[model samples]
Target: MHATTAIVTGKPGKARPRGGMTKKRPVDWLLLALVVVGAVLVIAPFYLVLVNSFKSPVDYATSGPLALPETLDFGGIIKFWERVNFPEKVWNSILIAGVVSVLAVVISMLNAFAIGIGRIRGRSWIVLLFLMANLLPQEALLYPLYFMFKSVGLYDNVWAVIIVFTVIQAAFGTYLLSSVYGTFPKEILEAASLDGASRWQILWRVVFPISRPTLSVLLIFFFIWTWNEFLIPLTFLASNANQTVPVAISVLQGDRLMDVTTTSASALLGIIPTLIFFLIFQRTLTRGITAGAVK
Candidate 1:
């Protein structure tokens, strides 16, 4: 039986002497083509914007959308910066977004930690209330919030915007952090308790170390959301100096119309910080999602 099997296998090998080279399968080529097509579709718009940013206004309007620019021009960017008070706007945006992100994360972490790990009664009801708050539209609360802020003399202040953003962001952040904390092993927490560690120590030493990925993900998301927020800022911030980046960009549109080049430049500028942030925290974001999924 062994001899017969060997003879059958030998015949096929002898029939194809050069079988060492594995031929490209049809599916492999098809998948490669699909990937190439998808990449082109995703990249084309950015390429158009970048090329057009360097073109003259006439060229930008008349030239084919996909065409490369003949020469680079900084006129659009220069005009945008001068007209928009770009430096001051950037400073305001950074301060607002940075404070909001930090406050949101800190507040969410405390709320989630208390509800998840502390022996607190009515946790479920509290969590449910937060979830319900998220279900309500921001517009629905705007009138009440406006009156409250006005009464408190916070209407046009940065604090008003910060408080609103923090409150809005905390609900979702707490929900996500709570879900993540729930997946943590009770045994580990119990072990810490058995070791006579204080609650604060256990939280700082063990819980935080393990939850870094999730925290990083939440921080990035909150920063992006707060930085790009428009409606709340527009409604609450009455002064030009206090306007965030999104609000500033909206105000770029004049009575007649906006300058296409300047608008495009400002739009591009608005995305730069977010793009930089994503590049820095992309790995943490991936890890956070994967950790959550595994848990």
Candidate 2:
């Protein structure tokens, strides 16, 4: 019996039936192709910008837009950096976005904690007001904000941009985070309370730790939005010294039209910080967005 069993074990197993074995599907291949195409389309422009930044004007004009630079050239970037005072502009954007993101996320978290789980009176009304604020077009409030900032003498001030951006982003942040906070574990809250934690303590120690993922998403969004914003900075930060990266880059466009290569390099430089930030926080961002979407 042992010999017979060993003989059977040495024999190769029979192949699975055609029905039992899965075959590659045409639909799966098609979906994969589509995804690849979409990725190329999204990345193509950035790749062009990166390669052409090192190209000479002659190289850019004569070669196709997608063509690689014939020779490495740091001259264009160096020239652009010097001409626009790129360091100062980059710093301006960083300062404004950093402050706005931190302030906006904190403010949003406080508001969401109050209305979401606290079940304070008129919660519906409060949520409705936030929705309304989000619904209003930026253009609709453009002139009003402009005049208000001007009247208060905050125009052309970094803090002016920080304050306005914080308020605008905080409203939207609260709207999203309210969903997350509302769905927070009741068990955890009860445990915290029974542990003799005050509402403020629970909010800071318990809720904040749990909601870190949500906060990361909101902070990234606020930073990106504020960093890329053009219209508000264009209007409010009229002075060259106070201009953010977007506004500064626009000004560079006018001054450097004769040097398109340098202009391209400048654009690439201006966006590098944002790209690095997104790449660093991308996983957390995806998780936070999907987590917040849960019912």
Candidate 3:
């Protein structure tokens, strides 16, 4: 009777679990949709501006906000370039931005390396001074700068704007690079030092390579800031030929403020280089900004 009465347990197989749920949450789809919508919203304005730049003034004025141009209007862009002395303005902007960015980065690297790596007695105080200098508003020093540049016969010169932009930008750049440098493993630096590597060698060979992303990011930022700077150039640069892109664009606004399309076209031209720069360094810039966010 015992052998005949075998028990038959009813346990679930691995294929048929107790709680079989294999669908994503509805909230996840909702969140993804929201993110897509937000991205579209953010991108739409830039798209409008860019597309509108290619439209004729009449087309731009009459067309729907999101409508594609029926035909390309290179004439408007050509007219804009001629009217604005676009090539000269672009050249001046490039030179100033390039020179200032390079000088700022070089100065920042040296200052950051010194303060970050060189065990100076008053390193903290030096860094604090830089922070304080960055805190000082440009407007507050404008008058003094104007007077000093005038005294030195540098007012209304490209060099004056270049020097001012470089100096002002260097403060922030130094602080940023120093923060990045501070995050580097000290043990690595010590090991390099023990291997008979000189300070310069370590900087060039060890630190610089690792810091490329941050440096590229800073370079792009400095270039954009310098290129778009208006007040400084307006104050120091008196000639159209010497004016940077921002100043040139501002002059366009003053001269043709009523002509919305021309002004918009000039604005678009001014923005092109910056957009190109971002397109070139987008990845490094993103990494640079997010470098220390996690750790």
Tell me the tens digit of each residue's lDDT in model 1 across 70-173: 67777777877777787888887778888888898888888888888773698788888889978998899899999999999999999998898899889988
Ranking by lDDT: 2, 3, 1
Comparing candidate 2 with candidate 3, which one achieves the higher lDDT?
2
Error of 3 at 240 (Å): 0.3
Best by lDDT, which number?
2
Give the per-residue lDDT of model 2 (tens digit) for 1-295.
5556557897545555567867669998999999999999999878877988999888888986788888988878988888778889999999999999999999999999999989889888888898889888778877988888889988788887888889889999888778778888899999999999999999999999878888998899899999999888888888888888888788878873548678779889988989998999899899988876663
lDDT of each residue in 233-254, candidate 3, tens digit only:
8888887778878887777778
Write down the worst ten-residue block by lDDT for model 3. Answer: 1-10
- Report the number of clashing residue pairs per model: 0, 0, 0
**Per-candidate TM vs. native?**
0.85, 0.88, 0.82
lDDT of each: 0.81, 0.86, 0.81
Error of 2 at 43 (Å): 1.6
In model 2, which runs have C-alpha deviations exceeding 4 angstroms? Answer: 1-21, 283-295
lDDT of 3: 0.81
